[model samples]
Target: MNRWMRPLVWAALLGTSVAGAQGIELLPGTPRPLDIRAASPCTFVTVMNRGTTPATLEGEWVNGVNSVPVAFDAPAVPMCEAAGTALTPIQPQRARTVRVKVNSAALGTLLGRRSVLEGHLVLRAAQGGPAILTPLAVEKPSLLGRTGVQRLLWPFVLACLFILGVALRVRRALGQEMFAAEWAPEKSWGSNLALITGLITTVGGVTKIAESVTPLVTLTGVVFTLLGLAAPLLYRATLHSLAAHPDRQAGPVWGYLLASLLTLWGAFGGLITLGALLDSLANRLSGTSDDLLGTLVMVLTFLIVLAVIVFSWQRLVQNIDEQLVAAPKRHRQSALL
Candidate 1:
């Protein structure tokens, strides 16, 4: 739900595309970069020349930023060398295998480190029509590389950011309403609807990503499913139950916020598989075994949070009811005077 989980989900989703990687051949009619991602030291790109006349291919590793030189030998590896493409051009209607070897030692430095190096491999014809800008992201063997994520991943992230921002704003508005003791149906009603929606969904998918944490965390999902449904049930029982308690504290705002975040993290694509776990306190400083003596800690965490929500709302309602009951007595006293 916090730092580790975000990238963990990001990488988990990206990693799925890696298994789909298969042999590819480039055609001459349209120019597209042979994007590659691999944990291995060597990456190969197949280039096919379907054009007339001989064409020569040249490559350069334009280290956009000079720091991490993972693409060090990108230029040296001559692809389509079956026909001596190094010295001679490939005749028309032929193919070549472009092997790009990464400095594993340099890339190895990124393992256990939470970082990635990005660089471009520029592939072009010596006659120079258009260059294929092959973007290469070299990192830990288990994380994302060669992910053709430009089409879908970025847009999804932007949408998630927008949703997260809105959730936080709603939580803030609810808090402000309770603090000011000026809850208005016109003003706060929309936020309460948002809260009800979040609470229900968050519980349904709370432990969906439990396997990534511990296989045992899944029981919480079942429990939260019922727990999360309660908000909706309350509405069904009394359409105005929530409306009556306008001056109510937002229970476990942070917990609810994180639950909302985790729901998205688990529901969206899990692109990466963590080949190695980063050593941090989240793993109890042991970052070791994947065995399952597991339990539902995330559930317990949410249980406590939801309990606070119910408890605070009940207390607020009782206080408000007492004031309403006493209001008539005070009015009668003023009339008698």
Candidate 2:
């Protein structure tokens, strides 16, 4: 503790505080620069404009000590890819997330073992203003798994269960003579297509959890997504047509069970698959940001459809239980006679 150096330290700290307060403030909860082991390294950071006027950000990643420009992925922010520049406009006092993906090779060289690579994210105002510098650091851990393959496995499992449910429903429905007799004519093609598409959608969704979507995956997903949405209507039409025919006396128990299974499964599973597809599209169009309004509408529709299906299923189950109870009583009454 040199007496002369102590005063200078206070002045430097005070100046740093004033500069931070004046310019863009890195929002709280912004992720610390992550350790990179994967070939493609990405991280999310948020910033707030504290200035009175509206400001746009023009970002650059630079080596902190030598001040050399570091090549990195551009259009880092989601949903604000406005034309030529990678500039993101922020209303004063508002916060926005900026996605940063640095070149792994360049970053690796700068980061040796025990080498803490410090850098600066320089955000210049779109209107030719002085840059705001935010310090950055990242560890080069040997392995990184933040892509969340493990987390996505749950959804893949759900999708698989949904597929199994659909298959069982199809098998049960086909076992009915009435349904089997009518099935092969007009509706067979659509049903087969639906099955194929459903499988593709499920497989594609699982793949998406691990890897990027290729054109083949996208195309198959599109077909599968469309069929998933349409399969319910096809089921409804077939069921209604069968119910209208008097000659088709598919026993009540089997009919009701299959109907309940198919209707509930179609509505519930269809919505889940549809949501996944739409989410994929939304992500592609708007980076990782959500489509809030679209999601709200989908959620509401799902609730309504789910409520109707559950009510119908409960009623069918109740009726089946009543018939079972009455059948035992009738048999006992006949024995007494």
Tell me, by TM-score, which candidate is best. Answer: 2
What is the overall TM-score of model 2 with all chains considered together? Answer: 0.30
The global Cα lDDT (0 to 1) of model 1 is 0.35
TM-score for all models, in order of appearance: 0.26, 0.30
**Count of steric clashes across candidates, in order:** 13, 0
TM-score of 1: 0.26
Candidate 2 weakest lDDT stretch, 10 residues? 328-337
- The whole-model lDDT of each prediction reads 0.35, 0.44
For model 2, name the residue pairs that clash: none
lDDT of 2 by residue, 105-210 (tens): 6555552212235555555555654454556665442111123342233334443454454445444333432221123324333234345445655576656742
- How many angstroms is residue 125 displaced in model 1 relative to the true structure, after the best TM-score fit? 2.6
